[model samples]
Target chain A: MRFAATVEVQLRPGIADPEGATIDKAIAALGIAGVSEVRAGRCFRFTVEAEDLASAEEVADSLGERLLSNPVIERHLTTIEALG
Target chain B: MSMRVAVVTFPGTNCEHDAIQGLEAVGAEAVFWWHTETSLDGIDAVVLPGGFAHGDYLRPGAIARFSPVMAAVADFAAQGGPVVGICNGFQVLTEAGLLPGALQKNAQLTFACQPCGLEVAQTSSVLTRGLEIGQHLEIPINHFSGSYVCDEATLASLEANDQVVLRYRQNPNGSVANIAGICNVAGNVVGLMPHPERAISPLLGSSDGLHLLGSLVSSLPAHR
Candidate 1:
């Protein structure tokens, strides 16, 4: 099965996120309304070949820990897409 | 006798020669220790120089933590000896668990290489003896994974122990609390993202790093 993975990365607390603040300012300028907070982060979407959703999640977790994300300031969350 | 220092060289370490020269300039007996070595005999301090060890493969400092040279460094620190890890060396230290927290990628997803200025938060450790709290200095930092981070409970402990050594004046990376450097629980091991050796000479447009290296020499006992 072709499993889709979405990984979100965020910096730890007390860490300065100037880039994130910049993005927040830019989004606010658009006057989109109702979006009070926005933190800058990395989003990676990829397709993995796996037997099941759990297997895909396992691969996604390994990728985040080993290559896609740094476990230090960046905490990665993986979500496997539900079958359409 | 002067202090005996060893510069451990892991595979892919490009800053070994520069680090050795920096130590030699200040009259420390600097020797190169390969990653394959197990023992660092007769050395008062061990410096893990900044470099792209293991090509930063398997995550920064991931594979290098188990290197043969790191075992020697672990033992050296256990004996109350001073250990300094700069840049990639800092990454290795975190991976090896010699220090707390870990280094993450820049939030902007850029490889930042530039002069980094920081304020010293504490100076009781062997690596920071010559600095003053809130004192300013410059060092050149070149790396992608330089963001320092830890959990809340650990952060509290670091603050309580006065282990936070250096903090970025103007944050270059999204490091937790702008923490550029920190020490171990016992204050013997220090790891920082900036390359102090790179700023030791004015020819590179900065001599502020001399304070960091100089502190190591100055902290030595009269007999060491």
Candidate 2:
């Protein structure tokens, strides 16, 4: 089976997000109101070849855990969909 | 005989030459070992110099940690051989699981390149054996992501083990507990964000780095 996966990596909560804060400040400077808590993260998309959807999800999670993110400071969420 | 230190260079590494020159100035024979090499034959110590390895893709040092040379470097360190990582090298060490903790983006979201003040926190590690506790040194730090972070439990263990080798006098990048450098529990592996190689001469504004590099050279075992 062929599945497409996207992994979203973000700094763990309580870890300082300087880039995110900078963006939030810029948003406020644009004269926008009520916009707060802007957080920045990275998303990686790729296709995986697996026997089943479960296998594909596993592959995506493994990639996110091992290579796509640093567990010490970042956390990742993986989403997979079967390709028709 | 002088200590033979292997300076590992990954793609995008730009500080190998400076590290070599600094090591030689301190009387250690420095040699370049490319990232592809799997064997660290006859190398007494290893130094991972600072640079944007793999262009800092997918986080600094994340890609570079998978290089073939790291396995050999890990083996060398397991045997009690000294290993020192500077700046990006420190990032690599953490990514490679050879060292604890991670370096995040600077608290101010700005790249810092300035002379930094550091206090010697411990003297048992390879990088600070010759220095005295509470002694201060002027070293330059150049990086955008240099903030050190680790869990509270790990921090407590590190403190208990005396693994914190250096602490920033002014907390340049918002590192926890003002940590500027730390060693593994065994004291054979060390990682620091400061650029000691850039401070090797009086003309460079300070030669305090010599005290650190000299300590590494003198701490090497005579046999290997």
Candidate 3:
């Protein structure tokens, strides 16, 4: 089976997000109201071949834990879906 | 006999030559070790030079940590062999778990490129083996993601273990505690944001970096 996975990686809470802060400043400068906080992160989408959906999810989760994110400062959320 | 230092280069690594030159200038024989090789045979020490390894994709040093050479580097470090990672190399060490903490984008959101002052905080590490506490040196730093970050608990232990090797005289990247470099608890491995290789020549502004490199060369066991 083929499964598509999307992993979203973000800085853990309390870690300073300088890029996000810079974008937030730009947003305020553009006269956008009520858009106060912003956070920056990366999203990775890939396909995994596995025996089943559970195995595919495991693959995505392992990728998120090992390569897609740095456990020291970043956390990742992975979503998997079955593919034809 | 001259100490043989392996300067590992990954794809997109641009500072390997400079590191080689710097090591040689300090009287060590520097050799190139490609990232695909998994052996550290006869290597006295290892240096991971700076540059955008793997094009800085998925964050600096993230992908490069998986290179085959890293497994050898880890084994070398585990055996108490000296290992130093400068600039982007520092990011690789962190990603490889050879060193603690991570390098984030500069707090100012700008690339910093300038000679900066650093104070030696620990003299037991391979990089600062004979340096004096509070001794200052000028070295060039060029990086955008050079800010060092770690959990409070890690910071506390780093302080307690005398693992914080260097601190900036004036914070350049908003690194926690103005940390410019750190060593692992064993004191054999070190990672720093400053480019000691780029500062080896007086023509480049300061030769103070030699002090650090010299320390590493001198600390190596006498060749038998």
Best by lDDT: 2
Q: After superposition, how far is residue B179 of candidate 3 from its true place, in Å?
A: 0.7
lDDT of 3 by residue, B1-224 (tens): 88999999999999999999999999999999999998988989999999999999988999999999999999889889999999999999999999999999999698999999999998999999978999999999999999999999999999999999999999999899999999999899999999999889889999989999999988965222
Pairwise TM-score winner, candidates 2 and 3: 2
- What is the TM-score (0 to 1) of candidate 1? 0.75
Which model, 1 or 3, shows the larger lDDT?
Answer: 3
Tens digit of per-residue lDDT, candidate 2, span B91-191: 99999999999999999888989999999999999999999999999999999989999999999999999999999999888899999999999898999
TM-score of 3: 0.97
lDDT of 2 by residue, A1-84 (tens): 899999999989998999999999999999999999888999999999999999999999999999999999999999999999
Best by TM-score: 2
Give TM-scores for every candidate, taking all chains together and pairing residue i with residue i: 0.75, 0.99, 0.97
Give the better candidate number (1 or 2) by TM-score: 2
Query: What is the full ranking by lDDT, best candidate first?
Result: 2, 3, 1
lDDT of 1 by residue, B1-224 (tens): 77788898988999989888888777788899889988887888888998888888756888898788888888778877889999999999998889988887676757889988889999987778888888999888898878777888889999999999999999887887889999998777999988888887889878888788878866763223
Model 2, residue pairs in steric clash? none
Interface DockQ of each model:
0.22, 0.95, 0.89
lDDT at residue A20 of model 2 (Cα atoms): 94
